[model samples]
Target chain A: MATLGEAKQMILDPAIRDWVLLPIMVVMLLVGVLRHHITVLITGTPKKPQLKAVRESKALMRGSQLRAFRNAIPPHAFASRKAFLTEAYDQGKYLKNPNAPKEGVPAPNPMTDPDMMEGMMEGMKKQVTNMVPQMLIMGWINFFFQGFVVIKLPFPLTLRFKSMLQSGVDTRDMDVTWVSSLSWYFLNLFGLSSVFTLILGDNNGNILYILGLHHYNEPIY
Target chain B: MARLDFEAASLELQQYRQSGERASERVAYLASRIIKDGYSAKLKDDIWPFYEQAVTAALDVGDFRLADECIENLKRRFSSSSRVQRLVGMRYEAEGKLADAQKIYDAILEEDESNILVSKRQIALLKLRGLKSEAISALVTYLDTYYSDAEAWIELCSLYLSVHAYQKAAYCLEELILLQAANPIWHLKYAEIMYTLGDYSLALKQYCRVIDLHEDHLRAMYGIQLCASKILDNGEADGTTEALKELATERILATEVNQCTIDSIKQVVREYLSVA
Candidate 1:
């Protein structure tokens, strides 16, 4: 439907642009840089793989690779390797603990497995570092800049953007191009990835990849 | 003065330095040569890595003063870095203060269990102090964490071989082969290990693999001939096995030294190959 008399051309205050838009974007950018450094700090050194666990995994890798590249070697050589590996597999020779009771033992809890637990702790640390600042900034923007339409999009959007682009502002008939502070935060959250990649190099600790924030896109999209 | 010849040594070490590779012996040579000739101070700022490399190399060659100077420069720049602290630990090691070095290594590991460099240096210290068994166990633990490290696998193999543990060495070589699938050297070593263990068939297979990878490898050709002759002696000869034995003999003789022809082992190989 066309606009009712094409009337609502809400002009946002220049003060909000100065006070809200620039601050939120700058704060988000700084937080992203800080998060990258924090993740680097948390990963103090490259991890040493546990010998038994590495052997266990590498043994499986070797077997699969041998099978895949069996043609690289002579057939008799492949046969010798296949036979040896098959026998080893049957006897569980490469198992971390071949003598462990297999019949009645329940699977090891992830919490109890120190290696897995350490991995989880590292992941948790990174996620917390990523999410905590994000949440705090979001809450801060919601409290301070709620319903304040801070910036206008350069191009026109459909009426469908009214709910998304004006998250905190409860404007019924305002243009969908007017972005309230909270949606601006959302825009900056996803949009600053290229900035982060430039700063932290190509293999960066990007927020979206670490926390899988794309999950948030389903309802919005 | 050839004693003042930093140019040649620097040129020789340029590739290693550019790639951040370790050439300990040559590094030790060039580093000492520079210090002895009093030319380190003249080096450019682009050679900042020279300090780190020189420090380790100086410590290795027992040039404590040079090590101290370089490490002091590094310490001023990166006072609390784990890598620098590791160099400090090696300095302590060079000074015969094994316990002090061990303490640093332990503390480094306590803070960061992933510092396999420290773990490796500690293992080397153990082996240097003649603690063979301890070194083996330490390396075993290191390998568990860094199983894909081909160098660590090679170290483990040599350690096993040092103790004359042929089977264990063979197992380590197997791991090495898997890790470095394209390297002819590991295959050759595995073949030698299998030969030692009297698994001639497996050894013969590995020898053939080495030959396939390295077409003109003298050692692999010799290995193939020996293993094939052994297999044929035990009456396991098929067509391909006989052909491999003959080919190895031909290649070994075709070489510049004409090994078999000169050494009279050619007659023995011919007789061995000619028997049925």
Candidate 2:
């Protein structure tokens, strides 16, 4: 229960700022920019989907749009479309596998589906690529710069933040604003995201996809 | 950014082109000017898009030689690019070799059915050949895949109108209205089509909707009066119909028109209001 008067302040050596803080920030920035470019290069141009596959999804979209905007059209046009789409839906005309067994059809084996496997592999590759660099940077920072306070936040913080900002340091009664090297690495990771978006375009890193918003498939207009 | 010199109008115009604007006429003029002045060589990689843009602009102004030269330059670089190939198709279309242009578009579509640019080009080619039915079917197919494209909806609507399929045209206009409810043009077109289809009540509603969005629309005012009179002829005249008719006439007479046409327009409005 240290009050504001009892809070301890430590003078950080300028050598820590020059060697640890600035270098970490610079490395983070360069790694971010490199990650963006590498993601672009790895993504290349997407392969074109099959014509029937495109038509199937689009036809389903058309049906849904027509249903949603049905009031816009006259009765006759709406009626005709309703009948046509109803027939198509009943016949499973837009299904990718319309001729498949209808009664008690076995669920597809995940490992046997090439598209499923490829998608999982792609996700795993991205995860590993994203994680390896960060883990390596964390280990490198820990090995060389641990057991030292790297930077100081200007504003005062409560004792609650001491464990967070002083993770690698064992000192008690130190001010919460003095952050350890590991915490500095985290600070760089969070702060450089905006810089990444500034240098790259807004859609960099497929933020929505990474957030699992793709499965929700929100109406994009 | 220093302002370019007064003599550098072409270079200034090039700024708009590089920034992806449609300064087609100036781009055409400058592209030829750049080649003549030996400045095209300096553009290097940037010259490709300039030539592509100039090709269409040159064709638009009927400079076949300049268009051909631009097309030639594009082909030398991106010989296999579908984009460059589409330019060649457009060049052939301008040359009045419709079949040749059709062949090129067909080849592109065969390779990639999802090529939206080539799909549109093929439809335009069909329309240019005055094959209305073919154009309508092609556009309908394109719209199926790109159900949200407002431009294609407008085109399909106009095509249906030209073919005298008022019901179908009305459907297309309804789709457009749903797609872009803010645009008064779609409401006006829908009103006109409903009027053509003899659904005067719906027509009047859509016309009033247009008025709600855009107060000074002359055609919509006229459409309101027309629909009011038609509804009156059906013995469905009400106080609101009469008021709408008077309002439309008052607004129409208040609007500005040329001196030569004002008297006749006033007379027409007077007779229309009297009938309603």
Candidate 3:
């Protein structure tokens, strides 16, 4: 069992704060700002959906609205609408390709579908954009600022956090509150989300944290 | 931002009611210019509503030629669009080719049974052709599918009132009240229906609600007086009813003082006092 002792006061070199802590934070923030602009550039104006798809979706929505608000209309009207929609849905009248195979057939290969391929390409682009900068930042932090205990958090953490908080510093008896430089990078990666949200609106901040976790869990080949 | 400008133009058109012809001409000219200039990439999404309003305004001012041009442009942009097709039907309706208009609407419905715009136009056409029952059924169908449409509910209420279906109209008003409880107009209409149905107590309560929502509503005050007197005549006069009657009279008198319609106010007050 670990016993609580009087707090140990060890001075951190000011150079660690200047070169490692502040630099990591600034770099992360700059990367986030850059990522937001790149995302905006890639997204551009949304392309209009095909008219047939629009009509089909609207038709489905209308059918659902009718089902929900059935009591607002008279019985005769409700009966006619229900019958019409049921027949249409059964016949697949509003389908993009009505002659396509019905239920119980094997699903079409997503690799061969142009729309599916486009979607996959978009996903790949997002993953690449997210992953590359993160890996570079981690590699840079580990190369330049290895094994330095940068700062102590105001709050005490449990022993489980020692491996995480004290990364690149292998001393076993070091307090969990004192984290190494790489852990400080991870802490800033999570903590500066609100500042990013204040700068870039709500949607852009969380993407960086998610990318960080993705790189941590699966090492990029 | 373009939509805001269109709305401002619409408001301006409303304000220039007497010079409607010139205003619509100006609107048509502006719309033509916009269509001619074409939308940049940023403004492409805004073109549809702009053209839609321009076409309607042109139609309103009896400029069939401009309306036709707008429709052609829209059809070129949105080929086989039921909305544009409905506009085509409207042009035929304006040209007094009712059969052709009906055929177009029917064809759109046949192609896309769930086209609510075409359904509404079809109902309006049926009403114009003096097919009241058909219009009512069609409206009921549309309302079932799109019950959130408050304007349609009001239209359905008026249709019922036209056919002397008081209960049905009251039901429509109830739906409207449920949908928009904050809107005093629906409450007033519901109170009016309740008055017609001889439910004086409920009518009085609803009229008081109207007063709560909109102060100094003259019609609701009159409704309160009528309901109070009716309740008194039935010898079911409660304290609340009597207080409501007194409050309504006070509001009416206060309004008369502000508007300087004292003679009419005195006459109404005298009638109410005599009834009491």
Candidate 4:
């Protein structure tokens, strides 16, 4: 067995071992040592995790418009459109044929009708109205919450709620929006509680490894 | 014929001199004409002396608009004149077009970086634009490379305070106090920072020092009373409270504290006493 100094020296060597592998090993060792005691210290084993506040509120908004835009694209538009366009746009002329005449037909005008114009106006209004609230909330959240100076929060619950929102959850479900909203609230509560217990699950994959129950762990990827 | 022409010219000049505003307008118009007509030889021989006389007369009467026009015409005639840019910077500053002023100042500084007035105006424009850190850095570099000016130090202190850099603000004020110890504002600001940092006793002492340095420092007097009350409320030691009360009494008797000052001091005193 290597001496403690030798073990530390061996761990630090640039050539002998993979640097990435060492951090991973350190994290695993920390988690195994500390995982059992985290719940006891944080939740005290007797108290059930409170769900009342979690079920009543809306989730904090996260992520950006670009992510949503990419996710919303329909899958079929690419394959069929590409196949049809490739043949028509090829540089080489069509194969030789005897006395062949090309036929031309004009496509119907897209934006010439009154009903279509009305619908377009309505869509534009809806788009603007939707964007206003999103921009306002995002601006407020960015300014107040992300200013260079840290603010003293009046309550820990607000911090917990903010953390839940920052978890990047999409809090909308099928016909009933309440289910998703309740789930978001609970997610925030659980997140804060875990943070209190030193078990925060970060969505950003930042270097802040949640200090485990009794020891340290590498950050969860 | 020559005598009649000379008499008519003298009467016209007299009329222009009698009406200052009219003279400015006439000077600007003639300068514009001379510049536009490429009448350089005529300007040198006759028009320039008349133009120089008009510009000096306009400046004497504080007619900046006419002065600006004259200077612009002069630049139009003498495009290589270095003095024209400095005058333009001053005109922009006087007009309160700070962005334009800054641009002109920057141009002047590029040609002559040691120009004090241009550097000062440029820093002021940076502060107005909310470029606080940049203003601070520029002024610091200017101070480091050249002799210090009291106005520059004061502006630097204000920038530090605006940015909530209390420690740096205190240090800057300390520098100024060393240079001119009688400034009550510096002492007040230093005391305010000390209060914020929970050095209530030290803050009270600083406030007392301000009062000692300037008997009419009502703000510092009020601050001392407030700090004393805070000390009482926090259940701190008795030494600071006795010292503060004594200073307040001294100022109250000496200056015959104005009701406004008394009211404000009482308000702070009440707040601390109630909390205590």
Candidate 5:
């Protein structure tokens, strides 16, 4: 209901008594923006941990879980013909049934069985063989290529420095004093921190040597 | 001058205490401050902070209705933020008003289908009416349009399993296996189904496969015993009862790798032989 000047005066009086005070808020906002830009530049290289190997190893373990119990629980002597014969002797009895009826016996030569043990062993070999390089590549990529795309950009300060050097500015002119005069020392510090963060910050790298990610008989690096 | 300074500091302290009293009292104080001083240019900065304080106090006291009014008033005078719509949506839903909740969730989803809160609320409403299939369909639809989520796949598979749809369950499991191929449990479950359908020979191979992968797989050991018994009976061309006894004796005398598994296998064998 009041005049616009009265409303304008009401809003500005507490925060800004005069136009001179606006510059302070503007300066703070500019600092915030510069800080944000530097952060983005440093963090642009995304490190994806070598997930494929970890996944492969987990898959192998799961496949193993699904299949068989290779090691016998009772000592072979106890469960085998030798143990039965010993037990019979200890009980003071002759062998009642030497060839007892049984179900689900493995082939006589399980190691030689083409369809069963041999094939599975081969699969295990393949899984282990494949997992190594995948892990190495992932680790190398993460360690080497952390801040990927952002570093490729024409960042303002980097551009300015390139131009300064190109214009025959002495290398000594690039010292802290000259840079400080540009009020960009803090910006550069923030930028470097961000780049390191982008390259090395992911937890996926640990998957490389983790036992569960490797093949059953494969050598892990 | 000392007296004036003392009075001003005391007035500021009193104002702080008065503002902290309650939502109604705080709102009244804010109204009085603006009404008396007219939110003039000289007081604009101070008034904005006071406005924020009053709005926050009202929301803290659960006086959301008044808070909405305050927000609307502020928006009319200033620029509105997307956060206001979010808060308004939450308040409307909290008040047990589904129509309004739906409207807000719809608006949010229209802008961002991946907004977790909007999807969550939307799913909640669909589930409340026992429309689980519809909810699942909606989730599937969302998944198709956006990200592929592993947890969602597992959830959908479990849902299908709960309903006793074995085919769908198998399909879901197969999809998961394709993504994570070495899952042992999936193989076990698939082998179990194959066993139940009387595919004994195939089941035996799976059991053997399991044992090969895991040297101590008790379940696979039990499966092996059953499959071997089936093989001993069926492999004989003459199908003689004598041949069955021969296979049975070989099994009973055979040394087991897992004693506990052998005992279980022994029991299952005895039961099957007795019935046969």
Candidate 6:
């Protein structure tokens, strides 16, 4: 149904492979290594939870364990615990602020809470660090390596991938396997996690994967 | 002007099996060295256990001064620690001041009723005071709050046994076996309890399970022999139990010659056979 010679064939320049493709990959690898160190530095030592909080959580856990393993203990023992825990929970004795009225409790204001503010600031810092270098590299690739299909993938892809694989190039008849430089950069971004892991430890890699997961779970509002 | 050698002190303490005047002298010497040298990383990490062992050793040797010093140091460092308070109670107990120890334990319980260490110490103090019923009740209360403590369960089992409450003791062993099914020791203990309760067939099954879990268990072999003969004498074993008993007998006889005391084993076999 289509013409035989409609497919466009453009010879890739040898210099683009050396200057654009390899440099982008090297820059991305370095950025990942740097990001891991920066993240570790920014997230300082964790603060210990308050003793009262610890006790409250442990009491809850104890109640659940007692309920689950009731038959493991004698009936008298189980009955006494069930009575004690029920009384405690009903009385709101172990609440963080036992005297505070339970009804009409105001929703937590994250802006007013210093701890919540600090947590938000940390999240922002992580997002900024993740985004800034990525944007810079992408812009650099688009600016310098425009209109160049940098590399051909081994496996053939469907026409649905045409827009993604040939971002800068306007040709519709080019093979889907031949990827533009921006697409190549995107591929290296997600695919070089294993290399980063080998260089850094297991915890250091998968930045793009983590960022994707974060974006996926972000609140709609 | 010699340097304090904590390693040598630890090694020397390990070598001495019996707690006597000599051992107490060694513990006192080590305690002095620890106090003079101040705390190191190792000492900071292991100070609790070291002081506990040293205090008990000092008490055994009648070196009350060293024990008192250790207790004072612990009190100063951990003023509000329930564990340290328990140790203070133990010091009072060792000094024959049972009333004072009871007071300390009561105060700790008043502060934190769920403190397992203080509860255990209080129960032990009650036992030492020869209030068996009080000890049992206290232990029951403690277990109601903290039932996951295996050591407490074992202690409760022994206390039940001491009162000739064989059924209660057997129940305790059943709980232990349920809790630690993989442990062959619990199986062996449950088997012994069953034997004492005159359930020979159940005991024999337990003994066989113990042997299956840990091959070449000498006591389990003897238990198997005793249980097999008991079952045979009563003529209560069915075909499967009879086959199992015959197999147990064959396995016991076929044990490697050097694996057991041959004479004692033969004597046990002969005794069981004659009874049958």
Instruction: Give native contacts recovered, as a fraction, per prediction.
Output: 0.25, 0.35, 0.00, 0.00, 0.00, 0.00
lDDT tens digits by residue: candidate 2, B238-272: 99998998888888767734332667766876675
lDDT of 5: 0.47
Model 1 ranges with Cα > 4 A deviation: A1-13, A30-149, A155-178, A196-211, A214-221, B1-20, B24-54, B57-66, B73-83, B94-115, B129-153, B156-175, B178-182, B193-204, B225-242, B249-276
lDDT of 1 by residue, B1-276 (tens): 446566776666666678876667778777767767777677765356777888877776787887898888888988788889999999999999999999999998887776778989999899989999999998997775566778888988899899999977877776666667789998899899889989888889888888788887888888888888888899988988889888887787677245444556666655654562
Ranking by lDDT: 1, 2, 3, 6, 4, 5
lDDT of each: 0.80, 0.79, 0.76, 0.51, 0.47, 0.74
lDDT of 4 by residue, A1-221 (tens): 56865654312234212332233334333432343333224332122212222211101000121123222212332234344435533421222221334447564465886646766765555344433433453344344333221121233343334423332233332112111222332233224333434443433111212222113111210
User: Which 10 consecutive positions of candidate 1 chain A have the poorest summed lDDT?
Assistant: A1-10
Q: lDDT winner among the candidates?
A: 1
Native-to-model Cα distance after best TM-score fit, residue B83 in candidate 6, in Å: 3.1
- Compare the candidates by DockQ and give the number of the best one: 2
Model 1, A1-221: lDDT tens digits are: 24755444566778887999999999998988888887888875657565566678877887887766665544655687899889988998889889877868887778888878878888888778777887799889988987788888999999998877888788787778889888898888888898888777776787455448667444753
Q: Which candidate is the best by TM-score?
A: 2
How many angstroms is residue B255 displaced in model 1 relative to the true structure, after the best TM-score fit? 7.5
lDDT of 6 at B122: 80
TM-score for the first chain in candidate 5 comes to 0.20
- lDDT tens digits, residue span A47-128, model 5: 2223333333443442343233222111331244344435644553332333534448743666665546745765565444
Model 2 DockQ (Cα-based): 0.28
Q: What TM-score applies to chain A of candidate 2?
A: 0.77
Task: Report how far off residue B273 is in candidate 5 (Å).
Answer: 11
Restricted to chain B, the TM-score per model reads 0.84, 0.85, 0.80, 0.61, 0.43, 0.79
DockQ of each: 0.15, 0.28, 0.05, 0.00, 0.02, 0.04
Predicted candidate 3: what Cα RMSD to the true structure?
11.4
Candidate 2 lDDT, tens digit per residue, A69-131? 776656766798789888998998877678977879887799998878877877776766566
Ten consecutive residues with minimal summed lDDT in candidate 1 chain B?
B256-265
Compose the digit string of candidate 3's lDDT tens values, residues A64-143.
Answer: 76767665444554687689889988998777678999889999999999878877877677767777887899899889
User: Which prediction has more favorable DockQ, 4 or 5?
Assistant: 5
